[model samples]
Target: MKLHALSPLERQDLIKQYAKSFSERAKQHDEEQSFPFENIEELKMIGYTSLSLPKTLGGQGIPLTEWLKLQELIATADGSTSLSIGWHMGIVSELNQKNWPDSVLTHVTKKISQNGFLLNTAATEPDTGSPTRGGKPTTQAKKVGSDWVLSGRKSFTSMVPALDFILVSASMDDDQVGYFLIEKGASGVRVEETWNTIAMRGTASHDLILENVKIPHDHLVELVVPGKKSPSGWLLHIPACYLGIAQAAQTEAVSFASTYSPNSLPGPIKDIPAVQSKIGENEADLIQARYLLYGVSAKWDAATDEERLEMQSELGVAKYHVVNAAQKIVDRAMRVVGAQSLFTSNPLQRYYRDVRAGLHNPPMDDRTLVLLAQSLFN
Candidate 1:
């Protein structure tokens, strides 16, 4: 079916309908640290895998804002699956927005639509940390005749096993930064199973090593001109992922509170005023976070390129409010559930771990606060 032809409400309904099965698949995937092939296949069958492809490419062309909302809904059901697929969706959406050459876009879109292909950004370097700094990439890509040879190591490549292509940021000989599309199974490219983390354990964010991997010139996306500011929307992906985690936390909290009863409590925990109050607080925080995210996203959609560049501080505010508040909301949910929240079988325990990952995401708390202060002061 042509999902792109559907109205916003229809698309939302379609996603909701599929979420039940996806949630079951996610639970299994999370426990085994396995890729959610079943869930992904379901997404492919429903045309969700090709949601971001351009209409010209024979695929649905969903807007990024709509895409983010859909992601939030899916995340509310299963965070690990959502987190895994959301990264791929974001990269695909961004590439579509870039309006690459028709041939390049068509080729990638065909792969995605037909095979449920996935792409991820491999930008995090071990030495320099987050790619937000726009630091000089330790990875180097040099012109070797017709092809560019890329040699570097990238850490925190989320959803490595499922990736079909990776956008690797590298420094050119002229000291310019550029993105190169490195295809899977490319010679000299190896994935190291190094993702040992406390949260998002199912994400498979392993380290990728490239040793003289060759990429065609057309694979290069854009050259990052020196002194140019980074785009604000790029940071939105981090918050988007966290928003999903937060919504999941809220869902689990409400479900548990409504059904679970303690020995001391007369009825379900939901009947307890204190538990109810905690649920209320968590709901309020989630609502606040959602508003901040959608509000900023609306502004972003309406913003011109220049206008968006100037709204760096506002973007930071959105990220800061949503991510930090969502963390607190999840914590409150855990408190409402009491000791049961810590059980391995309880989804709340996973929510706790997943939500904390946002703390380290870009637009770090200190940076956002500093930016806010600078915007208000001098």
Candidate 2:
């Protein structure tokens, strides 16, 4: 189960198989705003969902580098599904890095590997807005002897319908921040029908309300601080999701160009130099993004804690370049596809909407630029 247990080629093959299944269910999942239960089942059977868990815990022990590559492939096939599951995988990776109690790790990994569990963070709040501001959580978790009573509303809780556990951020004494693992069947915990969004609709990112919900003491994930410096590698997830969406748009564009021929054109649209130029640009952008992401990740993997902290500026640079380029790439793909790209039935329309969502994710354009500016000047 250790990362060493699987050869590099085997890992690649495993991801290839998962991507195939993801492609098959993507359209239906997007259309219905439904979870990809079949895809999850397939992943569980193949141990793809448990790749980040330690080998000692009866799970595949894949390295972070290899894991991100697999994520890119999965996202390319289906961005929403990849986004939903990527968070869970990230939690697993973080938990492993924290080196939790062996018993706790074993229990979580076994369940996830067996049943394909999903975990999502409930950190965003409507009033507080961005988590970077170190928002004072409205949700409060009060210690009641051996249990903690949680109460408050959490919005933008992605993959709620299929989530096995939610890592909710709450304030103790109404000032101190803490995280708790809230289960699906916990009393006083309810899911609100409030997930109508412009993109990533299949995520089912609804509201979670906990009114006097009780969680065990062991379920708490304590942190020394409210918002610690995020590792640069985390930003790669955003780019991976957007890059996948851009690739999807490119695929649609290529298909359209191959078949569609306008009355003014002599041959297929693909034969047109203008259309070819746009495709080439998209390809170059995607390639650049991938290279920057991988290069940054490699440095992060080998960096010391102090070095990693100092590289925050570099992290912003990667997110800024990749996400922005991906947006432009997707836009060009839409343009090459013509007016049909705007139709609801066309995948390009969905890609157009989804690609924009990356702009609003963490490391926002303004913040990224500010960080880079400070690094350069100060």
Candidate 3:
């Protein structure tokens, strides 16, 4: 009956149990560009929404290593679903680690654990691109009589239609930038369907527009203080998600090689040294990527304040290497599968597309390289 306090393997097996169903319907959701609400519900029923919360709060409170491995397994089942929910998982976990206000943390943890609520932050604007680029948001929040009127358009709002709590970044009249949490059904809030893309179609990432939306004064979560940005463990969730997707691709490649046999060949291609070599290559890189993610995550979990202060670029390196290697693993799998990998119905085809999305996630490759270079001198 109890899910927490279990061995890591036991917790992973439980998470994988739900992943199977998500894997089964992945293609359908992708084809229709529909949100996998059912997949999220299953995770909710399993108490996954609270996995990162502390046990004192009636949550699972899993560590970074185990949480990431579970994320990889879930990504294996469905990358879209994994990525969509990663926002919620990462934010809750990161908030728990911070000395930030309890108003936001208590409200979020209770809603997620008790009501199965989901969270996503909307910061990207059409003109400025990724929020990590240091540009002030165009979305403006004007102070009113004990309320803030938020007006802005957030592009690439992942899990838009399904989010229970939407965190919107806005530039206040006082020239301060902060994130405001908007609950579902808020007045003057609307989602414009606009998430048509070649990859990760099931993410339901659309444009969220706020026209004079009103919220309480406390809704502004935190203001960004330049040169004082705190390091976050939640961002690691992105790399972990990609690693899971790549693992899925590897699984499909190995299974395909062991089963398919050309009439001209004596047996399955898995027997041929060439095919074996390809799978071997993927396996080796996958191991590297997996270990890198786990090792860094473990280090982060154990790091004290002084150690954490030095991890700025280390975290980016983890994301860059893992995501790039993950993309490569999926590509190698496609090579093992040959031209058939291109078929619309082939999982490898989908894997290739999905894995590429990681390249565009936060801490982009170029930025990672820049960070690495800067860290060397400092």
Q: Count the backbone clashes (under 3 Å) in each candidate.
A: 0, 0, 0
Candidate with maximal TM-score: 3
Cα lDDT for residue 68, candidate 3: 78
Q: What TM value does model 1 have? A: 0.91
| lDDT string, candidate 2, 225-244, tens digits | 55465654655777777877
**Between which residue pairs do clashes occur in model 3?**
none
Q: Which window of ten consecutive residues has the lowest lDDT sum in model 2?
A: 223-232
Q: What is candidate 3's lDDT per residue for 109-183, written digit by digit as tens?
A: 788878778888898999779877787899999999999999889998998878889889889888898888899
RMSD of each: 2.4, 2.6, 1.7
Best-to-worst lDDT order: 3, 1, 2
TM, every model: 0.91, 0.91, 0.95
Highest lDDT model number: 3
The 10 consecutive residues of candidate 1 with the worst lDDT sum are 225-234
Ranking 1 against 3 by TM-score, winner: 3
Candidate 3 lowest-lDDT run of ten: 225-234
